[model samples]
Structure formats: C-alpha cells, structure tokens
Target: MAALGWMVLALVFLDEVLAAVAAGVWGSHAGGWPLAVLAPVVVVAVWWAFASPRARWGGPVVRRVVKVLVFGLASVGLWVAGHHGWALALLVFSVVVNGLAQLPSIRGLVAEQERPPAS
Candidate 1:
C-alpha cells in the first residue's frame, strides 16, 4: 500500500511536469495552474484512500475505484472545457498511472481476504 501510494505520488508529479511543459509550449498560464493544484489533490486523495483507517473496507479497492472514476470524469470534463491537447494527454496519462498504482494494493487486499482461517 505504501509503495502504491508512492507510485501515485510519482505520477502526480509527472502530471504536474507534463502540464507545466504543455502550458509553456502553448503559452497558457491558466492551463498549468489547474494541473498544479490537481497534483497535490491527487496525492492527498490517494494517501487518504490507501492509508486512512476510516476508508471504506479498510483497504484500497474502494478508494481506488472512486478515485479512478472521479478523476476520469474530471479529465473528460477538462477536455470538454477547452483544455484540448494537453488536457487530453494528461487525462490519458492519469488513467494509466492510477490504474497501475492501484494494482498492487488491489492484489494485496484480495490476497488478505482470501486467506484461510487458522485451524
């Protein structure tokens, strides 16, 4: 879970970098600002979803699902809202990153749940 969280953090950082580069290339400061803010939110959301004891199921699955859906929708919305090229790229990148990051946690949770009881 910790490792997965870190992976999500790395992806968020990558997204920020990509957004900055895109913004610079396009000469759109507005495009970069939203991504800058979103990066931290992504990190926080991932951390809370994976690390927080109060999170549903006390595991990463539910959180990951929610994060994927929310982020996916948000990305599409951004794309529709005139972000265009960079936004679309970022959205696709985020989906891939989040999916990969959640894999380990989902596997671990499943393994734990599938364990046999002591004799």
Candidate 2:
C-alpha cells in the first residue's frame, strides 16, 4: 500500500507536467508563436500560485478546484490539439488516480512517507 501510495504521488507530478504540455500544445493550436510560448508559462505560474503542493494561496477547496481545472483543461487541450486518445487517457487516469489519492489510507501513507524520520 505504501509503495502504491508513492507511485500515485509520482503519477500526480507526472500528470502536472503532462497537463502543462497539453496546455502548450493547445496554445500553439489556438494561437501562433507567442501564445505557444506563453501558455505553459501561465499554467506553471498558476499552478505554483494556487495548485502546487507548496502553493501559499487559496484554501484547500480552492486548491482542489484549481487542480481539477488544470487537469480538466489539459484533457480538453489534448482533444482540441487532435490527440484524442491521449486526451481520453489523461482524463480517465487523472480522475481515477486523483480520486484514489483522496482515500484516507493512501493519504496517510503518502503523508507518512513525507514525514521526516525521527532524529
């Protein structure tokens, strides 16, 4: 279970990176060079500000919503960018993994791993 928890944690980070890629691709399709360059930057900035683990802004609910939006938009972005299969995979994987991560047991395991060892 602990190992599974850790894997889930890793997946969460991977999901974030993929979401940025999706956003970048979408931007390139939505607009040309400038937006292509700016889209990922904006996504990263917003994640850092409100969705990242280290984020200082927003309450838990707000953070969760922001996270969902990021992932949700990523799914949409991939679809709009014409990567239909990828879009569906990301959508299902993100939803399932994220939902599973919220389970108390998994959260506890993740938290335990994050805790500093006894001095």
In order, how many clashes per candidate? 0, 0
Model 2 steric clash pairs: none
Per-residue lDDT of candidate 2, residues 5-105 (tens digit): 87888888888888888888999999977888899999999999998766889678878999999999989988998999999999998998888888898
RMSD to true structure for each model, in Å: 8.0, 1.8
Q: Per-residue lDDT tens digits of candidate 1, residues 1-119?
A: 66666667577657544543443333333456566465446644654555334554445566556555545554554565567775677778877775665476644654665689879
Candidate 1 Cα outliers beyond 4 Å, as residue runs: 1-8, 12-61, 103-119
Worst 10 residues of 1 by lDDT: 20-29
In model 1, what is the error at residue 15, expressed in angstroms?
A: 5.5
Which parts of model 2 have CA positions greater than 4 angstroms off? 113-119
Candidates' TM-scores? 0.41, 0.87
TM-score of model number 2: 0.87
lDDT of each: 0.56, 0.88
Clashes of 2: 0
